[model samples]
Target: MSRFDENKFRAVTWVQRHIANPLTRRLPFQTVLETTGRKSGLPRRTPVGGRRIGREFWLVSEYGEKSQYVRNIQADPRVRVRIMGKWHTGTAHLVPEDDARARLKSLPRLNSAAVRAVGTNLLTVRVDLTD
Candidate 1:
């Protein structure tokens, strides 16, 4: 799986720049989900790449099903996914589409120098936008 991540490092940097940085963050690309921790019930925030599907916003888990966000979704479907400054509330779903699967396979590579590079093959989980 990692062999496919030619730019795992660069991709991580891109993700951090888009998701972690405060000034340059934007939506439908660099987004964060503010949700409650399942066990602690405390607020937990996770950065994610989101897609717009029709009138509703959509999100996919590019990392895997074991991610904390996935667990959070299972615990409580109610969630707020933030993109850029604007945001939307939504529920998580498993869309199970070929395009989504292809997108997962086509993730941009990370630069070799970027710290904390990623290599694991991620799974996509779709998010259904809510009012």
Candidate 2:
């Protein structure tokens, strides 16, 4: 990564981690992705934006592997997602071949717009709702 990209990533991630995420995660309408903390072995919830279709939920990770939640997912694919105040257990799959830009087009607009604007290494994630 170039110096500019690295700097931008640091700035954006800081704001999201400290400010945006804390506020949004508490909202009942906001989608929350829950993962087992790789080190702490505790549940970690992150506010995300995605569209649920049938038994699948699709989302884009703005920071790819650098995102803490994505790293947690890598350690443990088993996860839970809260949608409309309901939680569902699922498995998260990282699709490197998928075009994240195109995938974002089919997701929730406001969040997608933010993701597209601030994302440096966009990656597609699909979660299969098992129950």
Candidate 3:
């Protein structure tokens, strides 16, 4: 990555981690994805924006594999997602073959707009709800 991209990534992630995420994750209506910490072996919940379709939940990760939650998913695919105050268990899958930009078009507008604006390596993740 170029210096500019690296710097941008650090800046954006820092804001999300320390500021935006902490606030958003507390919202009762915010969609949350709970993944096992890759190394910590504890549950890590992150605020995410996605749409549920049938038995699946689709979302775009702005930072791809670099995102902490994405790395957690890579380590353990099993996850729990809270949507509209209800929790659902699922397995997360990273779909590199999917067109993330096109997928974003079908998601919630406000979040998609932000993702598109700040995302460095857009990646599509599909979670198949088990219950």
Clashes of each: 11, 0, 0
Candidate 3 residues 17-39, lDDT tens each? 99999999999999999999989
The global Cα lDDT (0 to 1) of model 2 is: 0.95
Identify the runs in model 2 with alpha carbons over 4 angstroms from their true place: none
Which lDDT values do the candidates have, in the order given?
0.58, 0.95, 0.97
Regions more than 4 Å wrong, model 3: none
67 in model 1: Cα distance from truth in Å? Answer: 0.6
Compared with the true structure, what per-residue lDDT tens digits does model 2 show for residues 1-131?
78888999999989988999899999989999999999999999999999999999999999899999999999999999999999999999999999999999999999999999888999999999999
Question: Global CA lDDT of candidate 1, please?
Answer: 0.58
TM-score of each: 0.60, 0.97, 0.98
lDDT of 2 at 87: 99
Top lDDT model? 3
RMSD of 2: 0.7
The lDDT ranking, best first, is 3, 2, 1
lDDT of 2 at 37: 98
Top TM-score model: 3
